[model samples]
Target: MEQDLGIALPLDYKELLTRFPGGVFRRIEIDSPVANEKAWTKYKRALDELLEILGDEDLEYLDKVDYTPC
Candidate 1:
């Protein structure tokens, strides 16, 4: 799935998916990096909604974060 996405997921994220393949947690919807077709579509929809809420200003602020590896 990571290969299909063309990005390597964080180790912890990979571990979490391994622990819970369906990606459900306490009945809350947590987007899975390894989601199947249906789950991926749902994830994308949620992401689009989140992006809409974030707007350009919020995204610019987020882009300024120092994502450098420790």
Candidate 2:
């Protein structure tokens, strides 16, 4: 993965992926082959919405953006 990304990954990240596959840590989801489906579905929807709002010029979304869902 580091070779493909052209960047060296952190040691902690490598440890976490190996030790906590498909698990959540500090409110963050770790991607794995067995990730939670429901959580990912909601996450994807929110990400798409956020990207769309950011792409919009007149939405004034930055000031109104909320992170409670996260």
Candidate 3:
């Protein structure tokens, strides 16, 4: 279930995903660095869940985040 992405996910992210199966990530348009970080900090758990699903090999429980098609 591992590919060589060469990027390390933040600590506790996996745990958060495992704990909350309903979590999700919000694709941020980082126009404002301070605001984006603050928002991300508040929704860190959701981001972790999104990462978990994206990284998971099991498709049974994996759910993609909803985004508008451009």
Q: Say which candidate scores most in TM-score.
A: 1
**Model 1 CA deviation exceeding 4 Å by range:** 1-7, 23-26, 29-33, 56-70
TM-score of candidate 3 to 2 decimals:
0.28
- Model 3, 1-70: lDDT tens per residue? 0122356655576556445444334864332212345554546555567777666655644356454222
Pick out the ten consecutive residues of candidate 1 with the lowest summed lDDT: 61-70
Across 1-70, the per-residue lDDT of candidate 2 in tens digits comes to 4553367878887787667767678999665522456755665677669877667756554457654232
Q: What's the C-alpha lDDT at position 69 in model 1? A: 21
Q: Which is better, 1 or 3, measured by TM-score?
A: 1
Per-residue lDDT for 65 in model 3? 48
Query: Which lDDT tens digits does candidate 1 get at residues 1-70?
Result: 6665577878987798778776457897666645678877777677668767666554556577655222
Model 3 RMSD vs true structure: 14.6
Best-to-worst ranking by TM-score: 1, 2, 3
Give the top-scoring candidate (lDDT).
1
Candidates in order have lDDT scores of 0.67, 0.61, 0.47
- The order by descending lDDT is 1, 2, 3
